[model samples]
Target: MVRISQQRVKCIGCNACVEAAPYRWRMSRKDGKCTLIQAVEKRGMFNILVTDDEYDANVDAAMHCPVNCIKIEQV
Candidate 1:
């Protein structure tokens, strides 16, 4: 399974994750920070799954995040 950490303290509100993985990431209106609104489910395992085309986009977002808040993990 893949998952993103929910610690909002590290988020810089840069919206990198939102741009990289639009399907997985979203911006919160209250704070303008990027977050995962849904989980990626596959084969009974939950992953931080994004489309193949979104891989680079998401990676780029993670890299560009000023606070380095976005965490992509495999479980």
Candidate 2:
């Protein structure tokens, strides 16, 4: 399962996640942050759904964030 830590998401409204994983990610206008819309179902646990094809791009977006926020992990 893949997960992104909310604490580390500074979400500059770039919508990179949304573009990369349209089925799973979105931007929350209320909070000006990007959020995962779907949950991964595996090992009796739920994590954010980040597709394999979009993984590297999303990770790059996170790493290149001006605020240095965004956390991606697999468990």
Candidate 3:
């Protein structure tokens, strides 16, 4: 499985993630940060269980991150 996490503090509000992958990313009105659309709370950051269909887009979103806040890992 693929797991995703976002470190909001490192986000630059570039909206790259949102533009690249609207299905899983969103811009926060309160902080203008990029957040996982359907993420669940983990230790601190938001986490999402991703499928193979979303892997590429999510990875593209992570790559588009200006501050490199998004993390994708296999589990």
Candidate 4:
């Protein structure tokens, strides 16, 4: 499994993440911040678990994030 986590409060909405992984990330219309799709919010952070198929794209998302708010880990 792959875990994607984001410190959403720190997001700059640069769209790098969305560009890297459209399936797992998106631009929030309300705040212009990047939103983690299907994530559960907790303490200003968003998180989700996905299959390994999503790993590479999401890893790209994490690497492309200018603010370094996105993180990915294997579990």
Candidate 5:
């Protein structure tokens, strides 16, 4: 499994994550922040769990994040 976490409040809507992994991330029309697909919010952070197949793409997303708000980890 893989865990993806995003500090949505810190997002600048730069579109890096969305570009890297469109299947897992999207831009919020309501707030202009990048949204972690199917994520659950807790303590101002958004998190989602996915199969290991997602690891590489999300890792690219996290690495490309300008504000470094996105994180990917093996679980």
Candidate 6:
């Protein structure tokens, strides 16, 4: 399985992720951080559930984030 995380503390409101992968990323109104488009919480972590087809886009979004706040892990 694959997962993505946005460390809000490192987010700088730069919309790179949104520009790269609007399908999987968006800006949060409360904090202006880039958040997963349809993120869900599990085990105290917020993550996006993506299909294989969406994987590359998500990874690209992570890579494009100027603040480097995004993280990806496989389990």
Clash pairs (backbone) in predicted model 1: 2-47, 2-48, 20-57, 20-58
Q: TM-score per candidate, in order? A: 0.60, 0.51, 0.87, 0.97, 0.97, 0.75
lDDT string for model 1 (1-75, tens) is: 344544565666777777776777788898876666675544533336544555555566667778765556554
Which wins on lDDT, candidate 2 or candidate 6? 6
Q: How does model 4 score by TM-score?
A: 0.97
Give the poorly placed runs of model 3, Cα more than 4 Å off.
none
User: How do the residues 1-75 of candidate 6 rate in per-residue lDDT, one tens digit apiece?
Assistant: 667877666789899888878877778899887777667766645776555676777788878878777887664
Q: Superpose all Cα atoms of candidate 2 onto the true structure and report the RMSD in Å to 1 decimal.
A: 5.3
**Candidate 3 lDDT score at position 47:** 87
For 7-47, candidate 2 gives per-residue lDDT tens digits of 42345777766675565567787887766566544453335
Lowest summed-lDDT stretch of 10 residues in model 1? 41-50
- Candidate 4: 10-residue stretch with minimal lDDT: 58-67
**Candidate 4: which stretches are off by over 4 Å?**
none
The lDDT per prediction is 0.62, 0.59, 0.85, 0.93, 0.94, 0.76
The lDDT, on a scale of 0 to 1, for candidate 1 is 0.62
lDDT of 3 by residue, 1-75 (tens): 789889777788999999988988888999988888888876668888888777788889889887888988877
Q: Give one digit per residue, the lDDT tens place, for model 4 in 1-75.
A: 999999999999999999999988899999999999999999988999999999999899899888899999999
Model 1: how large is the Cα RMSD against the reference?
5.7
Which candidate do you rate higher for TM-score, 2 or 3?
3
What is candidate 5's lDDT per residue for 27-66, written digit by digit as tens? 8899998999999999999998999999999999999999
Candidate 2 residue pairs in backbone clash: 8-70
For candidate 5, list the clashing residue pairs, or say none: none
